[model samples]
Target: MQLSLPFTTLLAGVLLALNVNAVPVAQQPRMVTLPLKRMEVRSDEHPRILLQQQINRASKRLALMTGREAPTEAMMTEALRKRVLEVEGPEGLERRRVGLFGATKDKRFNRTGVPKNGKRSPKKGKNAGNAGNAGATGNTGATGNGGAAAGSSAIGGPDSATGVEVANTPTTGNSLGLNIEGPDVGYLATIQMGTPPQNYLILMDSGSADLWVASEACQSTAGGDCGNHQTLGSTSSSSFVASNTPFQVTYGTGAVQGAIIQDDITVAGLTLKAHTFGVTTSETPDFADDSVPFDGLMGLAQSTLSEQQTPTPVESLASAGLISDAITSYKISRAADNLNDGEITFGALDTTKFDQSTLTTVPNVNTQGFWEAALDAITVDGQDTGLQGRTAILDTGTTLIVAPVDDATAVHQLITGSQADGQGGFTVPCDFNQSVALTVGGTVFAIEPQDIALQPPNQDGSCTSGISGGSFGTSNTEWLVGDVFLKNAYYSTDVGKNTVSLAKLV
Candidate 1:
């Protein structure tokens, strides 16, 4: 969407020039942005929550895989937690370490109680035999706080309890909260054939794109743990074609073991000729976490980021020239519950669907994956308060606005007016009130009043709450502008156009 000329000032505008100093440079607003929006799927990179789920599911299959009496669930769970801590330690928290890039209990890192003085020592006291000097641990494999030693492969994902090297990536997430696995690639086709025909609610997560739902073959300790999603394998309308090859995935946080399956997958008016996907048979609660609607998930993110070795169904269709160019858009109308029932468009924004606006361009940090853009500044009552602070990461995954530690604190102070909430965040006295606005790209739009008062009440009647917008994540050094922020504006990412359009939500 076009920012009103009024929204953009000359100095803030993105300026481009050509041909000598002959012509004066034209100025436009520059949106401070992230390169992650650039396309390139780190599908192998799994979120912590998903990792926990995989670990949990893997615990269930450990007995079958190892052919022994598996230890109870809780034991495996604690072990995984400790393992991850050993590798990441607490320092990695600064980067808000999560996924593969951060500390995984699975890998190793550089750290120790004390360094060996500079000269090496010999195992046999030097005079005993001839050889390189060594400390007790033999080769002091580089120093890493997390994961396995530098040279060893960290089993596709992090270790759950203690960062140690293992020969192969664990096919089981048996210890995680939501653990399960089915053969990779082989599981994809089965789920497609299993899901019954009909509309279903689905989580549209960009990370590790693979679309599948729990089948009757699936098991969960949480009693029928699937979301508002339907089971494809259970439906007669459901079709299943099992591939001989198993489906396996190695995520930064965890892994998914399943099989590949291909079947008809449709969203809105869009339908695929033959979509390849996964059917997770492992037991885990991820699919059935809550009443969140959806028969399964839909991976519209780029293929490059896909967790699978095979091409993404969305990207495959886009390449074959099936849809309008792999452009997926959503209009969440919290107005009348459309917030939950919002539509997912495959090709482009259905202009006839809702209020449409001109698109703005954000240079892609990574051109082929999840689209991201620059956010110029964040304001409190129109003040350039958050500008000198951290930038905002506008993401579809998050639900609300999350300011940095400083910014989030200021917002809490302004809204709640409580000294107790100074360094920490507190909710406004339920009766207290104020406007919360964010300056994204160049436009300043205020967050809704209802959204501002986000915290629930406590026993003493003091309404302490989370940082105003979304959860305050210290790991990430930037502010998070999620859907709550997006709802105030019309947004679009045109990979072909190299443009991301934003307009007032109205």
Candidate 2:
């Protein structure tokens, strides 16, 4: 009873079977946009505290890029402490702490988790207060008011601890809204996860590559609760699958350690099934601060830069045919401008955000995974400063520009009345208005005078230069270019092309 058939027919049947079992073709990709919310700066926040945080964050970012362990917080603080003593004498350190932590009548500084008077000012846990908005859904402008869930709070109101007003009701579209916390802070975006979908606000960081969130059992490295932020895990999501792989990432200000897992994640009306990410069991206190607006961070850098060795969320979207191109664009807004219209677009550029005719594309030079490009020149008042052949890393996560010590000194020297502040920064007269422009890819972009000088805590007529001097890992010719410079331009990164484009804002 053997079956008989022509050779051509048999071959045709075999081919048909193979086609049925083979992988399906990817669908066409479309552009997706997300809204960004801006978190205002706290009236009580000290400039010195922000400065130190930026310094530490820059140091950590460099270390991570170079595959080295960053200096311990104690070591970094000790170095700054020595500088203070050398410049301001014995009492300078205490005075600095008082300014940063706020001084009580008795002259004692308020340290977190430390006893104030006889009672301890306990750190707020995740369940202590209401969780904010459950996140906006669809393109209809529907806002979900979160219940008294463990980590829920009312959206579009002042944060319970920080008193920073958060925006509510993101515009309807295939976009997730972004929140800009402050001038120097990074942006945050809302995302949905799990079977039924739970909303969480996470940082939209392009400087690093890895997605992570706190788990239900998470604790602070300081041996306390993990703040009043949201948490996710197998308990909250029935579809969560544990990978049993250990993961750890250390930032300049904080670190997290946990296990890698898989689940469904949705952003901007697109979903990635079985997406891989980290669930932190422990984190540093910097991230566990109750004032911190985001629950976790989602890195938008190249996959090679991922500490977990997994594809980034954007990459996953491209692979799944969710986006046509691996492009991410940012139109960050200034708090002082009060435009409140910052946004991030994935897959394609929002042509309306910038002048397409002025777009200048440059090759990304750092093969080790940063969005770095060459700095052609520096100009002050249209006069070339002779600074050339240096490179700049366009980092959205950072707040200020950190350049090599020699380069920073040279740039500052060109400005009148600019002097070293002895704290790795420079101070200039508040009224020193000059056109400072940076040349890249033969295109010149000017930085606003206001953006170059920030008011220091002293209320004196002097300002702290937004560009500071520091060493980045082992590269003395590299610059960490942050929002200070980026806010002046329309920035976009193309992973597929391995290039970065900047254009004058419209």
Candidate 3:
């Protein structure tokens, strides 16, 4: 599919230069690792709700990339709510405890508490009374505060919750750590931005290409609630350069709009100078919730997919020769594992994380700028489902697998005691142990039963399958393959080679 570029004319020359600069060879290949922290699951946040959100995000991502008019978060949520009510009845809705964006009434208002000198402060706006003040510490829960302490480097101290300590000084050839929120909701990396360098927890996404963070202007002007997350702009950064160009991006669950700006961004011990990205002045509640751990999002897809029409961080690193290659790899961890051992490596693949003997590489076939490859087949309990010609978009931002409607039904029909939830999803017995595997590049990657049958059974003693039905792309065979399947393997993408490699996890 051809991507309808929004700012093709403006970015044409920049894109050409980036492509040329991406080819220079480096003396030594460098690898930076980002450790991941698993989020504490809440009883109120249902797995089904997360599944719906993932579905919405996948759809909107495709819509935005294809230049289609994407539905607003309100429209998407209302549609889901209406669908649940119509198909499952009011009792089912109540049983699932479904609310706007899957957040309960009280959960929406339950903001993260900011402690001052070991005492909890009253509920107030993000950095209240200290808006636009770089020195003021913002939400310091799960992730550390946004403000950099005096005499402190860009990296913050150890996070008590995750037990991971970020180095105070930038280390050469070292990897920054990442926090995994919820059951693989997304990966969070603490990045320093601006002149003085304030820390911001950013969601690293491979499915989309665009970097953006909430701005202090949003919090100070009452333009929108940025929650207690960190923010940066001219108010907080002396070197921040703003453009008159407007920036807006819509995700499946949320949306943000602001102005294009240029600033310095440091990630994984490497700095990308004068990086152009968005500084959000307004954002939806999906991103404005204090319970949400990430302060912003960093899209790792190719520069062509970038809405900002700027080279991605990885691309910039490659162009600047900060890294030997424009490659990113993920060793995602599951909440069930409780290991907190997940990590994302940039520049080069970590051979220690995967079985090199079983490594297989496939060309990325999606022209619309997604890390996608052909899915040859799917087998349930060692039986072929006869499905064919399907492609899977490996997305880290998504939590579950979203398959085409017919393919989802075909796979679920093979599982014993599987029933359609009437909402484009299927519920299987909680104790489902059927062997499921996906065939890609003629290699079979088996999925664990725990990964297939999600946690927390429904009131009817049924658990939601990690796979659901959804529509994306022109053909119905496209699948949004997320952490549900990715966690079981070592997934990596080589931007320069335009190939995706998957290997058995060691």
Candidate 4:
């Protein structure tokens, strides 16, 4: 499939690079460790409410695919209940719940209190005592923020968040958790931009590469504006410089437009000098809605996928010799009702994030710059549907598993109760216990049933499914597997080697 380019510009132009001869070259280190912080960006919103909003938005896309008006909430509720019965039989209806959003009062859904901080106390993990070795410095077991007092070389570099030590690295890749909220909302990292460094939380997305932030000039319609989110302004930073490069990117749902600018970006204790990024001058109304938690997005896909036509942070790191490899790994955890957790490792894979030693690596098939691979086959309860040798994009920005119509129909038919909602997706029984698996690199990885449950049941017994039907390419075999499958597996992408590896997370 030809990789879809997200950004489309009205005016034809060229991005003129500015000279940076006077920029001071900063010293960097080999390895850096940053303890990630789990943020309650939307503390007041309930998970069910958020899920409902996502469903509503998805319905619009469904409308486009089916050539019909968006399904009404009541219609969706009834469709969900009917799908459950079709996929799971009469017994499935009996398994329905009457709790919040028809959620099974399952303790997992009602988790409360302050969520666990992503910044785990370094002293609590097996690596707690190993901080000395964990530090970028060699041989010395230097204690970090939460471990022991930072050795003279490490102490007081940055404020300790749960005893996390942020220091300069001589070289090597940096790894940090990519937090998850229920499904694939996104994992966020904090980067300080501008001269007097102001922090901006951005989503690390691999589906497209373009670093952008909301700017002070950002404007939205009456219905758009999410409250309290941060935006950047060049005037606030003494080091900020306008590159006069016009930039814009369109997302699956919205688009952002701005001009390119150069500033410093600090991530995982390493700073990239005179880094070029976008400051959004305009955005779609949806992005300003409360549903979005982060201020901006940071593209981590291959530079080829980038709209800026420049290297991404991960790519820049490699060019500057800050990391050992041009690779990125995602370990997205199930956040449930309270605790949001997960991480992303830049430059190299972190073995501790996975349950297995061997990674199933496959050659990337898309030349346009997506982490796409051939689908060996799909198995449902050990039965092959004969859907094999197809290609699919492994995307983290998406939440559902999307496949072409015929293939999706075949898979849905295998599971007794699944049904097409006339709207682009299937409605499956929340309680259905069928084994759904995907094969790549000659390895079959089973998907946990819970991972396929897109939305909880409502009081009326309606539940949204995690798998949907959408066409990325003309072929029926083209697919898109998002958090529905990613949360259950370990995904690694190496731009340098041009390969994508996946394994059961265990």
Candidate 5:
């Protein structure tokens, strides 16, 4: 069960050394382990529902940006089943390809003019610009390939795009523990900030790389919805320095606007002096809801993904020598109760939580701060479906396992009585007992049926499919493996080495 790291491509970033089988115990001090807990926001809100909504929204965003027509509920269901644009024969495929660019099934199906792939259509054509655009830009859904991360805002990309950007830079050192708030959505950490070290609750998001909180000088939309929450008062902190740098960030949930500033921060017994962060001047309606539990979010993605234009907490810790490497590990508890049992460790892996020497490390393909890897194929019940040539983004921020329509459909087809529910997911018999696994770096990792069965059955008592339909970008094969897959695997990421490893949790 020795962990094997196969280097395909090398990129600049932070490094993470888990219980490397080769790294002796004395040398493992470079890594640090932290306890994590699942914070439950609403007892009634199932984790699948919350995370599914995020995936669905992200999928629509990709479609809108790509200029795809809004899909009908029926159309979406078919797409999830990978039955869209079905070709019955060679003639049908040719006709379908012609219709793919712009021919609708209406009377004009045979009359409208559409060019072949990569061929430019007439300037007056509605899909002129869309033609030859095999390479579209945007925060792709799980099915995106060879594209920057969704909402990347990469070095040269738009400043306010989807996905987090990865920048190779040193960090301003600091450290502290976070308060576990809502497990149904995610975890929240309490960070000590300001001169007197006022405690501020923030969501610890590995998918994002920006640290922000509501400021006492903030404004909200209508109802006192700006969340009846505490704020970080600049005047109250003697060490606060206002930068007035305009800052804004968007998430699947909502967006926030504020100014960048530098202040002292503390977490997990580590103090970061003059750490740069954002103070919210305005927030979206989503944040203002009273149901929202956390005050702000502290991003732990790679430094390159930081939207505040500064180093992330882990990067800062690495720069300050507080941790050995730029690595993070998550152990999300699958318990439905508010046990607060999940743990997120920085700078190291918790040997207690994973099988001994069972780690498998793969190269990260994208530099946009997403923990993505090259996927070989997927197997259901020990049969390969040839779902290859795709990249898998290991997202802790997401709840369901999202894949390109075809791959998702293929996986769902293996299960008996699984069919699309018209809401970007499939409905399956709650009693499904099959093995679904993904082959990565030549290793086969199986997902238990219990993990794949989403809770809270429909009126018919059938459960929702753990696999959802979505595209990352122009690519037809991008996969987003969220908590559904992670709950069954020990996931770890090393920013320094640009590698993501997965081990079957014992």
Candidate 6:
């Protein structure tokens, strides 16, 4: 099946190819295909949860296509079943049928291995690609645009190395951050994008799926306030623009609105390619009140969350075939004092640079291709916390570790105990000596001393301003382990590995 890329992605590809015309076409937007494992098929087990979500999404598309309201989940499932039949005919979708997204009967996945449809998934399966997305014919997930790939293959590997085991491929010329720098995870992005906050350093997040900058256009009922984004036309920034894409980002906690623009968005020495950044034109004043500087935000979510959310710049680069592959993996650190400018490398993780072990990996769901892993348990020091190890979503996009509230409370209590703490969040003695360890992929990872000090429990010094309860909790059971846990580890989301690899930081 052929993949149909979004028009925006195609346009970006064309612009990039044209702007940097020095390279060869074959080399431009390069692509690589990695071998995938073929897993055994089963009938009794239920279809993977993600597949079910897709089925539901497809049903909505079907309803829209036919000019009708959306159907119930059951009805949607039935509709998809019927639609597959309509496309495949009375003989039924055969095992030989290829899915639009490079998914084949023989291809296996990390978490989503062996379809409920089994070997027949790709064989006339509905997943081959979306009939509408793959041009009008609906190639589904097939990469269009003369060989654009799904997710990060155009980069060094599947960002899935961050999540589940997936077939990660890479495009050419892009270096797989094989040795990317580890960034501090604790820094916060001052929401104030304009006006008061002028040159505040904000956290360049690659984890949480949405991109937002505090702006005056917020709809917070409490009041309108802008936090720390540089006000447009601010002198601190050498250059800034309002792209007119009026950006409004809705987070689990707040929202921001402004225009998208092409500006010089820089952090630490890494200057992002000239791209669409957000700025507040009309908004609530909460962002301005934050006292940070900047114009807007840069989205790092996967390409999937662009709709109804901040556009993921990272995924856009991948889809447009700009940077090689989606970033294979990322390293983060929580630092002392100021949050330093971290690094963001395209392609592979520089394994040679890190003093670590084998790279376990996982597949990344496109909505936001993040470094994801399954958590077997959270071990504090040498002890097993007995927390049920469910799949842990390692998101640079999010700020806090959102486990089941109860789980979070338990972990928080264990770390804080009856220490003399005020309100800055979790705190231990100034000279806490024990190491907090988290185990994944059968590996035990110990959190560094600084990382463990999450935050001092007081309104006191820099070291004291600490990590609060949950960074941001959602109304779900799935635990979102944010950068706090990721800082001490060298993580790679190798789609090819079908597993999330964890390595101890040197």
**Model 4 residue 207 lDDT?**
73
Candidate 4 residue-wise lDDT, 1-506, digit = tens? 11211111000001000000011122225434332223222223233333333343343333332233434435544544454455556665565434223523322111121122323112111121111113221111332223322332232222232212222211223432223332344455545566656545567666778888877667754334432345666655677777678877765446677888888876665679999888887775435532243467787678786667878888787788887677887766554423233556666666665666557999998787778888888988989988867776787765567666677778888886776666456667778778898888888888887776554564445456676664433443556677678877778888899999887764
TM-score of each: 0.52, 0.80, 0.78, 0.68, 0.69, 0.47
Give the TM-score (vs. native) of candidate 6: 0.47
* Error of model 1, residue 394, in angstroms: 3.2
Query: Root-mean-square deviation of each candidate, in angstroms?
Result: 23.3, 13.9, 8.7, 11.7, 17.7, 22.7
Q: Lowest summed lDDT over 10 consecutive residues: which window, candidate 4?
A: 10-19
Per-residue lDDT tens digits for candidate 5, residues 259-314, read 99888876554678998889898875445433343567777667676667788877
User: Which stretches in model 4 have alpha-carbon errors above 4 Å?
Assistant: 1-178, 221-227, 289-291, 337-340, 458-462, 471-474
> For residues 345-424, could you state the per-residue lDDT of candidate 2 as single tens digits?
78877877788888999999989667888999988888888877888889887777877677788889889989886556
Each model's lDDT comes to 0.35, 0.64, 0.63, 0.54, 0.54, 0.35
What is the clash tally of candidate 3? Answer: 7
> Candidate 2, which segments miss by more than 4 Å at Cα?
1-29, 43-49, 63-75, 82-92, 95-172, 472-475
lDDT at 204, model 5:
66
What is the full ranking by TM-score, best candidate first?
2, 3, 5, 4, 1, 6
TM-score of 5: 0.69
Could you tell me the lDDT of residue 323 within candidate 3?
A: 76
lDDT of 3 by residue, 298-411 (tens): 888887877788888888888888777899888877767766567777888888888998899999997867899898899998899999888888888766787767889999
Worst 10 residues of 5 by lDDT: 15-24
lDDT of 6 by residue, 128-176 (tens): 2221211211111223223322332332222121110111122232211
For 133-240, candidate 1 gives per-residue lDDT tens digits of 110011112121122323333322222211111212111110000001110000010011223333232344433355665453554434653432344443333455
Error of 3 at 467 (Å): 0.9
Off by over 4 Å in 5: 1-32, 41-54, 58-184, 223-225, 337-339, 471-474
